[model samples]
Target: MATDPDNPPAEVLAALAAMGFKNTYSGGYTHKDRGKVLDLHFQKDGTDLFQGWKAEEMEANMAAITALFSGIGITITPRVMTLAEAYA
Candidate 1:
């Protein structure tokens, strides 16, 4: 099951909320606003980036997330974006 890193399903977000993960981001599928920060492409725009939730958010709900994802046979492991290249 390949899931989109940019947009997790609403159902999943809903479940996450039921399990105690709350956020004020765009549809709960994005990180908090990175105002005035350059993106990976060096663009000084798009403060509200979208690429699923932030790492810290996941870290805070790892146990619940892992358990939920595992139920669907999806094993998720969190790692640094730069360091994740090694695993690839």
Candidate 2:
């Protein structure tokens, strides 16, 4: 419940960074032209949530997130939303 809101946990940020996501000043991370794939706003309490633009992207990122966080006993939830939902 106590989180930065403007930034993910350092470990999560580092992991995502290692996987090619770049943090932005607006409290989210993006990759290439993929837009914002991860954000603190998507997080729910103890869970780390990821929202990808497409199935392929979500699948790929899910695997990487699982691989990275599962080792440390953290749970990552990956989701896909339409562009409208993503913006709304």
Candidate 3:
């Protein structure tokens, strides 16, 4: 999720909480002038959920996506790696 910790929307927080996720740590992103963070959560059944939000605010279109996946108990686990980090 591309979001600032200070002002995450209510819906975002609630959905994350319901999925049993907890924010572990985050890092600063100089290029984007935004704080890039990694949030981790685990399900007892060992499911994975990964999604991203890049817009200024939660756009109406994207909101439906999470809801649809979340309702079905689907977690989209993405393979996250930076180009530099991966090549290193």
Among the numbered candidates, top lDDT falls to 2
lDDT tens digits, residue span 1-88, model 3: 4445456455765666565555555454433545554443332222223454334323443354466567767675545699998799
Arranged by TM-score, best first? 2, 1, 3
- Clashing pairs for model 3 are 50-76
lDDT of 1 by residue, 1-88 (tens): 2234455455766676687555433322333553232122111112235645455655556776788888877888766567667578
Give all candidates' CA lDDT scores. 0.52, 0.57, 0.50
TM-score list, all predictions = 0.37, 0.43, 0.34
Per-residue CA lDDT of candidate 2, range 26-46, in tens? 444455775544444322122
Ranking by lDDT: 2, 1, 3
Using TM-score as the measure, name the better of candidate 2 and candidate 3: 2
TM-score quality measure for candidate 1:
0.37
**After superposing candidate 1, which stretches have Cα over 4 Å from the reference?**
1-8, 27-60, 80-88
How does residue 23 of candidate 2 score in lDDT? 47
TM-score of 3: 0.34
Clash number for candidate 2: 0
